[model samples]
Each structure stands twice: as C-alpha cells, then as structure tokens.
Target: MSKNYHFIAIGGAVMHNLALALLSKGYQVSGSDDEIYEPSRSRLKAAGILPEEKGWFPDKIHQGLDGIILGMHARIDNPELIRAKALNIPIFSFPAFIYEQSKEKKRVVISGSHGKTTITSMVLHVLKSCGLDFDYLVGAQIEGFDLMVRLSDAPIIIIEGDEYLTSPLDRRPKFFHYHHHILLMSGIAWDHFNVFPTFENYVDQFSQLAAMTPEKGAFIFYEDDPNVKKIAAEVPNTVRKTPYREHPAVIKAGQTYLLTKKGELPISVFGQHNLQNLQGAWEICQNLGITADQFYESIASFKGAAKRQQILAKSDDSILFRDFAHAPSKLKATVEAVKVQYPDRKLIAVQELHTYSSLNKDFVHNYAHTFDAADVAIIYLNPKAVSLKKLELMDESTLRSGFKRNDLILFTETKKLKSYLENQIYQNCNLLLMSSGNYDDMDLTTLQKTINKQHS
Candidate 1:
C-alpha cells in the first residue's frame, strides 16, 4: 500500500473521505485546502488529520511523499501541485486512483446526470441490510455508513459514477475509469455545460462507458428515460442489458411502500424518482445474487443520503425538506414527489440558481414549466455569486421571461427571500427548498425552524 500520500483540495467531501479511508488503512496522509466546510471540517478534525487552516504550501511537497491525489476543485497551477511536479512525484486524479485501487473488485458503476447519489446509497443500504460487506464510494452520507467513501478488501465496489471531468489534468469522465462488471446508466441529461458543450456530446460519454463493460457484465438502464433506453439499445449482444421502471408506490397515512413482485415492501425513502432509484438498486442487487426478500429487508431501514430529499425540520402538519436539485429534471421530479406525497398540502418550492449551468444566461430557459407542479415556485439569484462564477448576469426579468409560469416569484436578494418565507402562511403547506448552494448565505436551518414553529 502507498504511504505518505497528500491530497490537494482535501476539504471537499469526496477528498476528505479518501483521506480518511487512507488513514484507516494506516497510511501517513497529509492534505491542504484553501477553504473547508462543516461535516467535512469536523470529520477531518475527528480523524486527527485536519490540514493547516490556510492555503496550500509548496514547502510541504517534499520528495518523501509517496503520491499526490488531485481533487477536482484544485486548479492545475496550484503551488504545491507545481512543486510536486518539479520533484517528479506521481500524481493520481481522484477517479483515476479509485479505478486503480478497485480494479480487482467487481465494480458496479451507477451513472446519470441526476439521482446517481441516491441510487448508490440505495444499493449500499440494501447490501448492508443483507449483511453483505462491500466497499463503496458514494456521493453523500448514508444514515448507517460512517463515511461516504469506503475502500476495503471486499469482493465488490459500488461507485457513484459522475459524468463530470475526472480532474483538471484528466479530461475523461470519472465513470470511464471504473472497470464495471455491472453498469447502470440511469439516464443522460445535458449537464456540466462548461465541459460537454452539447447534448449529443454529453450522451456520448455514457455510450462509451456502456461499451467498456465486459461481455459478462450486466447493464441496468432506466426504461422511461428516452436517452438512456436509446443508448442501452445500441449496446452489443454480449453485455446483458436490463431495463427498470419506478417501483410501484402507494402513500397510505403518510408512508411509501414498494409493491414488489414478492410482496409489499416498506422503505424510509419516498418520492417517484427515489422509487425509480430503488428499482435500479433492486435489479443490480438481484443480479449480484441478492433475493427480493433481502433487498426489501435492507431498504426498510434506509433513511436516505445527506441533502437528497433530506427533511431538515418537521412539525405536526408541515415539514421542511432541502434537496440537492439544481437540474431541470431533478427540480421537476422533486416538486412532483412532494405534491404526490401530500396531496392536500400546499407546496412552496424554492430554488437557488447557484450552479454554473443553472446560472448561465442562455440555459435558464430550460427551467421553463419545471416548477409548475409546485403551488408557489421561487427562484433566488445573487449577482455576487454570478460574479464569483464569472457567468453572465441574468436579471429577474430575463429569468422570469423564460419560465413558463407567469406567476412565478423571483428574488435577487437572500434577505428578501428569507423575509418572504418568514412572512408567508405555511399552514397545511410543506416547504421544499432545492439548491446546489446555501441560497446566498441564508440559513436553511433557521428557515426550517421558523416554518415549523408556526405550524407547531
């Protein structure tokens, strides 16, 4: 095992998880980051491996280091990275190393523009429930899993296969490196426009990944998504292709259960997209020799991954849920899920335009008609954030013009959005705040508490 490795931009969730996994395996790990956030910050501290509070240090890149793992957040011109290069030390992008390390394990690569995190979590949940020990690298914190990333001498390694560029130096998508014995292409939607630039180009990445799987490998696909179905249909006869649909769901007295072929199985996760995620997980687990009974038993205790349809606060009548939904498809699915779960309750779906793609002036039109399912839809944008991302400014009017809902409310200031939420009548209403950001530094917990207080 390689020892004395250093991680560049180690404060990120994935970066820190890799650091901790290395630490657990008795490797001397050091890291640097320009900034850090909670959970990642505290977890690093707990591991007794917190990096120096400041930015990278070139002096830290000595010749004794075994290797350098570059995170996606770090630029190529990073000082320590340049210094490491000068010394001719080996460097591995996060995904490149993950692929190298898990080459022997039967890799199950879960890919999609959205719901990859949830699907990975769902499979891990079922695996754990069945007492099957497997290594995984998931995007979010599952309820029972102490760490989001795990590496071990297990026979299987399940990974959330992101379609984004691997690293600054490696342009191949992360999913490409995974030598998948079982490949699940959830669907392809246009995302990471800063990289792929066109819809067909984005779809091509998945097509390539599908082609990589061996003849004995199974390719699980979404039966409903046209892009996924089309791509899966194009694959050769050697790879076994399995298509999945949303698990049949019924909401009875505020509970969602899967109407499986075996029986009615209950789960802590709800919503139609999650139901689809469960279906995909079930098929993959089944292919791994897990029976339907074992899959349902594991799913019963799965409380969901962090920030993906996470219920932050709840009172008697109204609950506040926050999600990592910035894509048009995700936003639509999340809003529809909340509506279906509580048919009689009003829904306030608030979203922040924080991602580079979401903040793009030309791409805002893709969000048209997405939030029509919500009773009240709000989009919050900050010019400062736009400046930070260096994206073109899209004013409230230009954004509103593109949205099909004429009555859709828009806010440019965090304070105004906070105030509107504070003053609103939330009775018999469930508030769903969706974003890839903090909504311009506003406290989501404060909003959750404020809304719950009124209902209580």
Candidate 2:
C-alpha cells in the first residue's frame, strides 16, 4: 500500500517541491497552507495537491495518515498541529523529513551563509552529465531542472543545508537534522538576527554542524573566509578536512573561461565568488568519483541557479541582472563580482532592505561600504514592510549613515524607484537588482522592456 503523507504549510518554495516529489514517488500526498504564493501555487494546482481553500482544516488530520510534515510557516498553536499531536501522528519538520527520506544514502550537505544553492546546483548538473543517479534538494530552480527537490532510490543525495530554524515546534537549525556524511562550508556571515540574535550565536550553529560530520566523513570549507577557517580548525582529526579556493580563470571580452591543462574553457557563469563555488563543487564531485576532466566538461554548460546572478536582458553595451542577495557579505561579493567582471561598464546597483535583519536599525551598520564597488548605489525599503515586520521605522539618515555612502540614492516607493530607473541611460552600463523581495512587487518584464529599449 502507498504511504499517506500530509504537509502543513505546503505552499513554501521547498515544501511545495517536496510535495510534488513525494507524489511522483507514488506516495498519497495532501497539503494545506494559510497562504500560497506564485509558482508554488501554480505547481501545486497542476499536481492536484493545492488546497481547495486558503486556511487549514483540522478535520484533514486523522489516525489513518502515515506521517505529517511541518513547514516553518506554521505556528506551534496551529490547529492542524494540535490535531496531529492529539492523534499521536509522527510529525517531521522539513529538514527532519528530508533526513528521514535520505537516511540510507550518502548525504553531501552544503552549509553556509551564502553560495549553498550555487554549489548544490553545480554538483547536480555534473552528476546528471555523468549519467549518475542522485537525489537533490536545492534552494532555487536551476536552468534545466523542473523542480527544486527530488527524492529517489539513488546512492547519494545532495542537500543545500540551511542554518535557519527548522520549524516553529523545533527550534534547532535545519542543517543539524541532515546528519551529513560529507559537509561543505561555503562561508559564514552573521544573519537571521531575529532568531540567532548575535554573531556568536550564529557562528555556533556552523560549529555544531561541523562537529556532526562522522569520524570517517569529509568536511570541506572555503579557505579564504576567516569564519570558515576558525570552524574548520576545531573539527577533530578523525574527519577528513579539505579546503577549496577559487578556480583559475580569465575574463576575455565579457566572458569568463576556466584555465585548464586541456586549455581555456568558456563557462556560462562569471564572478570570483561563482568561481569559488565551482571549485567547491569540483571538490565534492571528486569525492563522488567524478574525474576532473568530466567535472569541467559538465560545468561548462551550467548557467546558474535562478536569481543567483540571473541575467534578465542584455545588449552589446548593457545588461540587467537580478540576484537574491540580501545579507551584507553576499551584497558586497555580488557588487564586486559585477564590477570586476565588466571593468569598462558602469555598474548601477540597487538593493532592497527586505529581510528582517536588513531593516533593523541595529543590523543596518553591518552593510557599511558594501556597495563601494558600484559606480551608483541605490537602496529601497518599502515603508509598509517595516510596519508589517513590526520593526522600528527606518529613516533615510539611518540607512545612509548605516551604509556610510553619502551619495547613495534611497527610495521607499516602488513607483518612484521604477521611474528613477526607467529614466536612466543604460549605455555602457550594467543594472544589478539585488534583493530577496521583488522591490515591492515591481514587474520585471515591463522593467526589462523599458531598460532594453534604453540600452538599444
């Protein structure tokens, strides 16, 4: 008989994908969410798993269900959760359930403040190219993959481990549950201030994750990041510790090519950070029995994960790109990457202060000089977001002083920001939209059309 599983708050990015994965695996899947966003909603509707209504139904839970998967969006007092507890049904957090599903396989977990998605996607692409069977759970939708989560009877599973809280009922970090046999630490920067509350608290989670690697397992880290270095040094000698640096590459006429003994090979992605990501992926692939030559050959066609340096439109003189860079370290790396990748073109970088940490007056100071590489820096924060998050209202002076950029342009209204961008001359310039949000629902297609016209 097929196992029956129900998802609470299943409309999330990974939650919906996980639902579809189970359905594909022949499990009887059902789910509910108080709110469902695009792509998730559309995908769930297509799969016939989308909730008929917007809210939860306690009657949906019963003793007949095999298991219950909980998402972080649900509250401790959620009615469905109460019913599940009363019925003594097994409740698994997103990461916990993923760990359960892949327990028999060798788990390669990618953990850090940034670059987890890129590295995971790179490994998946290479594995597919080599015709190796593997399951994966990446944060974003890659260029060629249809879903972000997959579960099968493969020998190995590649998981993008996150440091965020697992669920409302379980306060432990998500990565803590993965129990990785092989661990990769991309880099560490303090984030999720609302949960961790301090830099030391945030770093402690990574330390614990490093300690979780089995004695015979491998722990890979970026050698350059000081935070990663400190964590790597503390891990016991029983675990194999490997370090990776940026791949040797050269940029010619706006294209980045890896310098290999086989010769210079062009790739679809650019930036030093991405090269570092590639190196990390290569190290993991090596452990998985893929040869260096095979890895390089497969990586050449890897465009990138969605919203990680995703190009929206391009012309000879100008290009517009969007990235999900909200943290200070990621913001700085992305800005510098673009500027260094195209030295001749001016960089007009705009980022939205959407995350809870970014909008906090106390955390704002961390962003100091992050946008220094850009020729033009613009910051946007929707005023209603402040109220919605119940944070202290931020003023222009606080943001300017926090970023320490006297000339930074600040906008609170999406309309004004769009108008300001539409009026700019994009000739010989690059426009970078960096945010975890959509600039308060700004339409990208219309903006792309307007900007492409200006560039032409």
Candidate 3:
C-alpha cells in the first residue's frame, strides 16, 4: 500500500517541492496552507494537490494519514497540527523528513552561510552530465531542475543544508536533523539576527554540526576562511578533513576560463567566490568517484544557479546582473567580482535592505566598505518593509554613517530608484543588483530592458 502523507503550510518553496517529490514517488500526498503565493500556488494547482480551501481543514486530517510534514510558516496553534497531535500522527520537520526519506542513501549536506545553493547546483550539474543518478534538495531553482527537492531510490542525495530553525515546533537548527554522511562547509559569516542574536551563538551551530560528523564521513572546507580551517581542524582524526581553495582561472575579454591539466576550460560563470564554490564542488565530485577531467569537462557548461550572480541583460558596452547577496561578506565579494570582471566599465551597484538583520540598527554597521568596489553605490529600502518588520525607519544619514561612505545614495521610494536608474546613461558601465527581495515587486525585466535600450 502507498504511504499517505499530509503537509501543513504547503505553500512554502521547499514544502511544495517535497510534496511533489513524494507524490512522484508513488506516495499519496495532501497539503494545506493559510496563504499560497505565485509559483508555489501555480505549481501545486498543476500537480492537482492545491487545497480546496486556503485555510486549515481539520476534516482533511484523519487517522489514516501515515505522517505529517510541518513547514516553518505554521504556528504552534495551527489547527491541523493540533488535530495531528490528537491522532498521534508522526510529525516531521522539513529537514527531518528529508533525512528520513534519504536514510538508505549516502547524504551529502552542503552547509554554510552562503554559496550553499551554488555548490549544490554545481555538484548536481556534474553528476547529471556524468549520467550519475542522484537525488537533491537545493534552496534555489537551478536552470535545468524542475523542482527544488527530489527524492528517489538513487544511491546518494545532495542537500543544501540551512542552519535556520526548522519548524515552529522544532527549535533546533535544520542542519542538525540532516545527519549527513558527507559534509561540505562553505565560509561562514554571521546571519539570521532574530534567531541567532549573537555571532558566537551562530558559530556554535556550525561547530555542533562539525562535531556531529561520523567517523567514516568526510568534512570538506574552504582553506581560505580562517573560521572554516579552525572548525575543520577540531574534527576528530576518524573523520576525513579535506580543504580546498579557489580554482586557478584567468579572465580574457570579460570571459573566465579555468586552467586545468586537461587545458583551459571555458565556463559561463565568473567571480572569485564562484571559483571557490566550484573548487568545493569539485572536491565533492572527486570524492564521489568522478575524475577531475570528466568533472571539468562537464562543469564547463554550467551557467549558474538563479539569482546567484545571474546575468539579467546586456548590451555591447553595458551589462546588468543580479545576485542574492545580502550579507556583508557576500556584498563585498560580489561588488569586487563585477569590478574585476569589467575593469573598464563604471560599476553601479544597488542593493535592497530587506531582511530583518539588514533592517536592524545594530547590524547596519557591519556593511561598512562592502560596496567600495562600486563606482556608484546605492541602497534601497522599502519604507513599508521597515514598518512591517517593526523597525525604526532609518534615515539617510544613519545609513551613510553605518556604511562609512559619505557619497552613498539612499532611496526609500521605489519610484525614485527606478526613475534614477532609467534616466542614467549606462555607457561603458555595468549595473549590479544585490538583494534577497524583488525591490518591492518592481518589474526587473522592464527595468533591465529600458536600461539596455538606453545603452544601445
């Protein structure tokens, strides 16, 4: 008999993907969410699993259900959760359930503050090119993957492991539940202000994860990061510790080519951070029994994960790119990447302060000098976002002072930002947008088109 599973708060990105994965695996799947948004809503509907009603229906939850999967969006008092508890149905957090499903396979968990999605995507790209069958769960949408999560009878599963709190009911970090057989640590920087509160508290989570690596497992880390090196060194002798740095690459005429024993391998992605991510992915692939020659040849065609240094539009002289870079370290690296990639072009870098940490007064100071590489630096924050986050509306002077840049341009209004961007002459320039949000739902495609047209 097919096992039946119910997902509470199914409109979430990973939640919907998991539901679809389970459904594809011949399991009976049902889900409910109080609110469903675009992409997720459309996907669930197409899969024939969109709940008849928006809110919870306790009648949907019965004793026949084999298990319940909870998302981070649900509250402790969620009615379906209450019903599930009453019926003694096994409730699994997202990460926990992922571990449960992949128990029979070797789990490779990519854990870090940033670059997790990119590394995971790179691994998947090479594995697919080599015709290796593997399941994966990545945070962002890769170019060829239809869904973010895939579960199958494959021999191994790659997961982009997040350190955020799991479900509302589970206080532990999500990575704790993964119990990875192989772990890849990308450089860590402090994030998630509300949950972590302090840098020490944040680092502790990674330390605990490192300590959890089993005797037979491997821990791959970035040697360039002092924190990563320190953590890796602490791991017992029983576990394998492998450290990697950025791959050797050279840029010629705005294109980057990896220097390999086989020869110069042309790739679509650029940036030092990306090179480092590639190296980490290469290490993981090598450990999985793939040769360097095959990995390099296959990875040459990888463009990049969506929004992680994704190119938006380009003209002969002016190019536009967008990245999901919010943290201070990522901001600095991204800005520098653009400057180095196109040294002749003037760089106009714009970023939106959307996350709770970015909006917090205490955290703003951490962004100092992050945009120094950009010829023109601009910061945008939706006033409504500040108010919604229950944060004080930070004035221009405050941000300027925090960034330690007197000439920084600040915009609270999306209209003004758009107008400013549209009016600018982008000749011999590159525009880079960095944010976790969509710039207050602005039409980025139209904006990029206008900029490119203006440039032409």
Candidate 4:
C-alpha cells in the first residue's frame, strides 16, 4: 500500500522538496504552511501537493497517515504537529525520513560550517553526470538538479549534513541519523550560536558527526582547516581517512582553471575554498569507485550553489556577487576568497548582521578583521532585525568596535546604505554582499544592476 504522509511547515526549502519526492513515488502527501514562496508554491501546485492556501489544519492529521514529516520552521506547538502527536502516529523529521529511506544505501554525508551545500551539490552533479543514479538532499537550488530532495531505487544517497539540531523535538544533530558509508568534513568553525554556545562546543559537533561514520566507512576532510584537522585526527578508527586540499589552479582572463594531476580542468566554480570542495567531492566519488576522468567531466558545467559566491551581475570593470556567509568564519573566508580570486579589483565587502548571534554585542567580536581584504568594508544591520530576533540592539559604536575594522562604515537604513554604495566608483572593483537573510527585503540584484549601469 502507498504511504500517506503529512508535512508540518511544508513551505520550507527542504520540506517542499521532500513532499515532491514522496509525491513522485506515489505517496499520498498533504502539507501546511503559513506562507509560501517562489519555486515551492509553483512546484507544489504543479505536483498537486500544495496546502490549500494558508495555515495548519489539525484535521489533516489522521490515524491512517503513515507518518508526519516536520520542518524546522514548525514550532513544537504547531497545530498540525500537535494533532499528529496526539494520535501517537509515526512522526519523522525530514532528516529522519531520509535515513529511513536510505538505510541500506551507501550514505555520503557532507558536513561543515560552510560549503555544505556546494560540496554536496558537486557530488550530486558528478553522480548524476556519470549516470550513477543516487538520491540526495542538498540545501540550495542547484541547477541541472530539479529539486533539493531526490529518492530513487539507486544504491547510494548523498546529503548536505547540517550540524544544527535535527529538529526541536529530536535535539540530535541532523547528520547523526544517516548511516554514513562516506563522510566529508569541509571545515569546522564556530556557527549557529543559538545551538552551540561556545567555540569549543561548536567544534565538538563536527567531532560527534565524524564519530558517527561506520568503522567500514570513509572520512574525507580538508586538512588545511585546523579545526577540521583537529577533529579528523581524533576520530580513532579504521574509517579510511582521506584528506583533500585545494587543487592546482590559475586565474586567467578573470576565469579560474584547475590544474589536476592528469590535466588542466576548467570549471565555472572558483576560489581556493571551492577548489578544496571539488577535491573533497572527487575523493568521495573516488571512494565510491567513480573514475577521476568522470568527476572532472561533470564539474565543467557546475556553476555553484545559490548564494554561495554567486555572481549577481558583471561588467568589464565591475562585478557584484552575493553569498550566504553570515557566520564569522564564513564571512572571513568568503572575503578572502574574493580578494584572492580577483586580486587587481578593489573589493567592497558588505555584510548584513541578520543572524541573532551576529547582532549580539558579545558575539559580534567574532567578526573582527574578517573583511580586512576589502578596500572598503561596510556592515549593514537593520534595527528591526535586532528587535525581531530578540537580540540586544547594538549602537554603531558597539557594532564597529566588535568587528574591530577601524575604517568600516555602518548603516541601519537601506536608503542610506544605497546612497553610500551609489556614490562609490566601481572601476576595476568587485562588490561582495554576504548575508543569510534579505537586507530588509532590499532587491540586491536590482541594486547590483544599478551599480553596474553607473560604472558602464
């Protein structure tokens, strides 16, 4: 019999994909969401799996339903979730369901503070390109891949292993559930302040994830990252440990080309960190018995994960990019990557203090000297964000003092920030805007185009 499943907070990026995958597999699926956005709304509507407009319907939960899959957005008291709980029916978080589905398949989990999506997407792209059928759960909307979640009769499944709690109820790390045959740790740095309060605590989460890999499995890591190295060395087991570093590459005509041991490979994805990600992906595929030639062929067309060093617009002289780099380490790495990628171009690095941790006057010091590569560094934090996230409102003095960049400009209003950016000459310059949230719904794409027009 076909399984009947209901999703709490079905409007989420990963949740919607899971619903679609189940629907494709002929499961009776229903879902609820307070709001819906692009791709999810259209995709759900097309698949005939969308919730009827807006809200949690407790009546939707029933005893006959096989299981309820919950998203992180759904509160513990979510009406639909509460209804499912009362029924004592099987409930599965999305990650839990993935583990349930891929129990027998060889699981390849990509875990780290940053580059999880990129590394996972790379593995998925190569696997698909080589016609090696495999299921996957990646965070971003990857091109060539239609959805974020895929399930099939394939013998393998690769997942972007987020170190955050599995669910509000689970309290376990999301990556802990999967039966990992192959594990890759890109790097570990302090992140998700709400989850792990201290730097050491945040580092320990990766260590725990590493230990979860079976003794027969393989643990792939980026040895360049000291934190990743520290955790990799401690996981004392026969889990065949493989280390990867940045591949040889040269920047030419504003394009980056990688020089593999076999030959020079040109791929659209750039930066030393991304190069490291490619190496990790290649090694994971290699451990899975994929040939070196196959990995390179698939990576040729790979652009990148959405918002991870994604180019917004470009002109001969000016280029603008955006990234989901809110955490201190990610922000620093992203800035450094861009500066290195285009050394001749002046970099104007801008970041929005969107996360609760980043806005915290106490935690703000973590971002110190992160944007030192940029010719001009600007920190944009919305006052409304401070109130919404329930964080202490920081003064310009406090915010500036925390980042410790003396010449940094700070702004609370989009108009003032826009004005400041508009006046800047972008000649031979690159504008990098990093945030995990919209800058108060400011259209950065339009702004990038406007800036490009001025310079053109």
Candidate 5:
C-alpha cells in the first residue's frame, strides 16, 4: 500500500527533494510551506505536489495520514503540528524520517564540519559510474543527478550528514539520527554559532556521531585533522577504524593528476581539501566492494558538487569561480585551493559575510588570516543583513582587526562591490566569489556577461 505523507514547511531544499523522492516511489505526498522560493517552488510545482494554498490548514491534518515529516523551518507551535499531535499521528523529524526509511539498508554517512557534500557526491558519482544501484541524500545537487534525495530498494544508501539541529522541536543534531554502518568523518571545525556557543560543544557532536556507528560498522576519517584523529582513536575497538589524508597527486601545467601505481590519473577537481575529500570517498567505495581500479576510473570523471569550487566563466586570460564557503575553515580552504590552482595568476577573492556565524562580531576573529592566499581579498557585508540577523553593527575597524590583513578590502554596498569588480583588470587573473548566500542578490550571470564583454 502506498503511504500518505504530509510535510510542514516543505519549501526547504532537503524537504522538497525528499517529498519528490517519495512521490517518485509511488507514495501520496502532500506538502505546505507558508512561503516557497524559486527552484524549490518550481521543482515542487513540476512534481505536482505544490500546495494550492500557502499556510497551514488544520483540516489537512488527520488520523488517516501515515506520517508527517517536519522540516526545520516549521516552528514547534505550528498549527499543522498541533493538529497532528492532537490526532496522535506519527511525527518524525526530517533526519528521523530518513532513518526510518533507510533502516533496512546499509547506511553510509559522510559527516564533518566541511567537505560533507563533496565527499558524499564523490561516493555517489563512483557508485553510479560502476553500475551500482543505490539510494542517496546529498546536501548539494551534482551533475547528472536531478534530485538531491533518493529512496529505493537499493541495498545501500549514502547520506550527507549535517551537524545542524534536526528540527525546531528536535534539539538533536541531524547527524545524530542516522545509524551508520559506514561512517566517514572528513574533519571537525566549530560552526553554527547560534546553536553551539562554544567550540568544545560543537566538537562533541562528532564524537556522538562516531559512537552511533554499529559495532561491525566501519569508521573512516581524515587523520590530518587533529580533532578527527582524536575521535577515531577513541572509537570502540569493535568498529573498524580507517584514516586517510590527502591523496598523493601532482599538479602539472595547471592540471591535477592522482599518483597511483597504474600511473598518474588526471581528475576534474583540485585542491588539498578536495583531495582529502576524495580519499574519504575512496575508502567508503572500497568498503562497498568497488575495486581500486574501478574507483579511480569513476572518480576521475567526478566534476565536484555544485557551488563547491564551481567555475562560472572562463576565457583565455581570465576565469571566474564561485563557492558556497561561509564558515571560516571553508573560506580558508577555498581561497587556498584557487591560489594553488592558478599559482601564476592573480587571485581576486570576494567573500560575503552572510551566515549568522560570519556576521557575529564575537565570532569574526576566527576568520583571521584565512584570506592570506588571495592577492586582493575583499569582504562584503550588508548592514541590512546585520539588522535582520539581530546582530550588532560591525565596523570596518573590527573587520580589519579580525582579518588582521593590512591589505584587506571591505564593502557594505553591493553597488560599490559590483562596481569595483567590474573595474578590475582581468588579464591573467582569477576571480573567486565565496558565500553561502548571494552577494546581496547580485546577478552572477549578469556579472559574468559584463566581464566577458569587457574582455571581448
């Protein structure tokens, strides 16, 4: 029998994708989001599950419903939730629901402060290339994958585990819900300042995730990160613990080649972080019965997850790249990667302080020296964002002090930032835009066109 599922706050990226996945599986899926945004709205509309009306209706919730999947966007006092609770309908947090569905399958969870999406994407790419059928839940969309979440009868499922809170009502972190048979930890860095006040509290989440692995499960982690190394050492002896560092590779004429016994294999992705991510993925794939040669052949074609070192435009003399790097660790790795990729070219790096952690005056100091790799480093923040986030106004001196780079440039106006970018000489230069959010809604396509036109 096809189960009927209703989602509250269905407009979230993962929630909408999960709804579509269930719909594809012949389940009756209904969803309601007070306000839906582009991409999610359009995709849900295409799936024929877009609610005809916005906001919750208590009438939509009843005892007949098989389940209610709660998204993080919905508050604990949501009307739909209240109705469902009153009716005694089973309500599951997003992660809990996913766990319920994949409990029968072998779960491979990639968890860390950074590189979770990239590592998960890598594993998915290799599995798909090797003709393996598997279900997956990745945080970011990847090339050739139409959806970010998938559920099927496949014996295995790969999950990109996030450390954020599961839902408004469920205080547990999302990764805690996943009972992993194969767990991979890339690294641990303190993030989500609003939820985790101190660095130690944030690090404890990974230790908890490590403990959730079954006795016979495998724990793969990056040994380079001291925190991850410490966690791996403390795991129960019953679980198989494997550690990896950056894959041995050489860069020749701006191309990265993996060093293997077979020979140097060229790959589409670069950077030490990505190499480490690849190593983590390789270990997971190996545990899944994929041969080393087959893994290499498949991984060489992996282009990387969207927004993680994605190229926006390129020309003979100049190029433009964009990354979803808002956290301090991600910011440092991305800047270093682009610089390493084009050593001879000038790197013009622009980052937006949009996340709660990045915008917080108290947390800004963590970003010090992260942009040292960029020849011209620029940080952009809109005052309106600070007001919206309910954070204190951070002055230019505070930002300058936080970065500790005398040459750092700061901008509060999108127009001024755009103007400065437009006026820059692109000859033999690489432009890198880093942000979890858009630069105050700047049209990147238009900016790319303007750069192309100027170069033409």
Candidate 6:
C-alpha cells in the first residue's frame, strides 16, 4: 500500500532521515520546514522530496494524506497543524509514528541520558557484522551506515531512544512511546532542565519507561548507576532483569584492550563509559541469539559513533579529541576517560556551554567539580547564543561560582578562545573539546592544521 505522508519541520536530523526512509519504502513523501539546514536540506533535495518553497501551507494538509509526521520544531499553532485539526487528519509525532511502523517487529530500544547512541550504534555494528538483516534508528551517524534511520521488512528494529520530549505537540518523552521487547538503559542523569525541571522529575521519566515495558520483555541496565539500580528494583519480577557494568579492560601505553575469556580483544574504542556501553550492547546481542564469541569478534572492530570522544587530530606528543558532552555527568566521564587513558599527558579540557540546560542559571550548579580531572579547564559560551535563546546572560563570576573552580578560564569570544589555545604550550598535553555545538562555528579542522604546523 503506497501511502501519502507529509512531514512538518522535516529539516531535523532524525526527521529528515525518517522522511527519506519512508520514500525509500515506495511511499509518497512530502515535507515543509520554515528553514532547512545543511545535510538535511541536501539529503532531502537528493531524495526529490525537498519542498519547493520554505514555509508551510494549509493546503498541504488535506484529506488525501495518509498521516502527518510532526517534528519537534513545529509549533502547536502552525497553520498546517490547525488545518489538520480542522479536517481531523491523523497526526503523529516522529516517535509515535516510529512505534506505529515497528509495532509488529521486535523493538530493541536503548534508552538513557548518556551512551544511548553509542550502545545503539554498537548493536547495529554487531548485528550488521554478523550478517543479520535488521532495521535501526540511531541518533548519530555510524561509520558503515549511510542512513541514521532504516525501515524494512526486517523482523527486528533497534532504536536509540531519547528521553527528550517527542514533539512540540506531544509532551511525552520520546522513549516512553517505544514499548520495547528488549530495553537497555545505560544510565540516568538529570538533563533537559527546560522540559524536566528537577532531578527527581527527570529520573521519573526513566522509571515510567521501565513500567511501560511488557512483562515478557527484558530490561537491561547498567548496575553501576544508582538511579538505574533503583529503576531496576522497581521493575516487575515478570520482566527479565539483566544488569551490566563496565567491561574489564587493560590499558597499556595509552591503548585499551578488553580482557575477554577468549583473551585480550583489541577494540577501536576506549574509556569506562564506552566499556559500559559495550557491555550493555553485548547483553542485548546475547539476548538476540548472538553468541558471546560472535559479539566479541564484531565489537572489536567498532570505531564508535561520531562526536562521541572522536579523535580529531593525533601526534606523538599531543592528541586532540572532540566529544558531545554537554551534560554534567557526560563532562565528568569524558574528562576522566582522557586523563585515565593518557596518564602521562597533561589534559587541557575545553567545554562549550551551548545547550539550554547548560546555559540555565539554575542548572549550572550541577556541573560543579566536573572538570577536576583536567589539568587545565576552560569554558566557553557565546553571549549571542544566550541572547538568541532568550536566556539571562551568564557572567564569568556566575560561571566560576557554578563550577567552583577558581582557576577556570572562561571565554565569550571564539577568536580569544582560539588564540589562547593556539598560544598554549602543547608539548605533552591532550586537548579535549566537549560541546553539543561547535564552539561558535570555529573551524576545528583549521585549528588542528595550524597546531600541527606549529609543532611540525
């Protein structure tokens, strides 16, 4: 059955991918976004579904459409939405629509504040490595996979479940919509302060996700996280409960090797968080009928997802890494990982406070002591970004008080930050740039080239 689907705000990373996926399935796909950005715009253009013009038209929302998939960027009072409501046209949030499509297939959802993308990518990598045919919806771009979302006749679907709100209209957390046949939670940490006001409120969302899992389903979680442990305890006995911790590994000479019963298995990824993610992925694979040996073999080749502790540049004396670590828990883990991996090298950690939660005055205190592992800590925030987000301006004193680090260097200008970094003595220092956004659009590759030129 060829269905006519319309997407509102299809410029989003996940939304655009889903639109392409539906088009690939022989469905007629049409979409409109107020403004489309790179990659998404280009991808949509290539697929021939790119809207001729920008803004939405109520005429697009008609009775002939099978369903309208809404993106988070669309507003409640959007003209298209108003028309759809008037016509009583069925509308679905991306997450809700994903559930609708995969209801018949076995859904394996990886959910948590951190490591969901890594774990989901790990599972996809392993499944593909084992020659298994499956559909998947991961957050980040994986190395081997061209598309982030895939839909097919595959009996199993792997999803990277986010706890963030599904859409502007759908206030429920995205993960709550995924009734998992197999659920894996890496850990829980308070984030999205705008949506979830308090730590307790944020934690409750994960608990609700656990409660929604069917009795016949399996709930796998990282036992190391106290919050996860609590969630595990609350699950019904009818649900199979499995717990995992960081995989045992030996770090020798700045290289990490997993110590499996099969002996030392060299993997492309490192850090305790990644090890824990790997363990969670291993458990998920085991439940999916993949043997331990097979899991180990496939995981060894896993290079990790993009921007999750990705190596930007490396030299004998100094190495540079860029990671998407906006949250406090993620910041602590990422910095600790780099310091632990290269114990001999001094670590200079630079993080950008770009996200809404990170920029919020009330939420800033959660980041206290997160940069203790770094020899030198620097934080950057663009005042323009704060103004655009309509957030109160955060001065250096407020940031200093928040992190409680007297020696912390703060920057409001990208040029100053870049100049400071370039002038730094990088003899034996590892530079780690952590941010969900690029540091005010600074060209990291250009900076890396300059740094290499200086040292060479």
Candidate that would win on lDDT: 2
Please give each candidate's TM-score: 0.96, 0.98, 0.98, 0.95, 0.97, 0.97
For candidate 6, lDDT tens digit of each residue in 1-456?
A: 799999999999999999999999999999899999888999999989999999999988889999899999999989998998899889999999999998899999999999999999999999999999899999988999988999999999999999999888879899888789999989988899998988899999999999988978999999989999999999999999999999999998888999989799888888999999999999999999999989988988898899988988777778889999999999999999999999999999999999899999988999999999999999999998898889997887888899988888899999999888877777788899999988877867665875465456
Q: In candidate 4, list every pair of residues with a backbone clash.
A: none
lDDT of 2 by residue, 174-272 (tens): 999989999999999999999998899999999999999999999999999998999999999999999999999999999999999999999988898
lDDT of each: 0.87, 0.93, 0.91, 0.85, 0.91, 0.91
Stronger candidate by lDDT (1 vs 3): 3
- What is the Cα root-mean-square deviation between model 5 and the actual structure? 1.3
lDDT: which is higher, 1 or 4? 1
Quote model 4's TM-score. 0.95
Residues 301-371 of candidate 1: C-alpha lDDT, one tens digit per residue: 88888888888888877888989998988998899988988888899999888889899988878888889
Worst 10 residues of 4 by lDDT: 443-452
Q: Output the number of the TM-score-best candidate.
A: 2
The count of residue-pair clashes in candidate 5 stands at 0
lDDT of 4 at 136: 91
Model 5 agreement with the true structure over 400-434: per-residue lDDT tens digits = 89988877888989999988898788888889999
Model 4, position 114: C-alpha lDDT score: 77
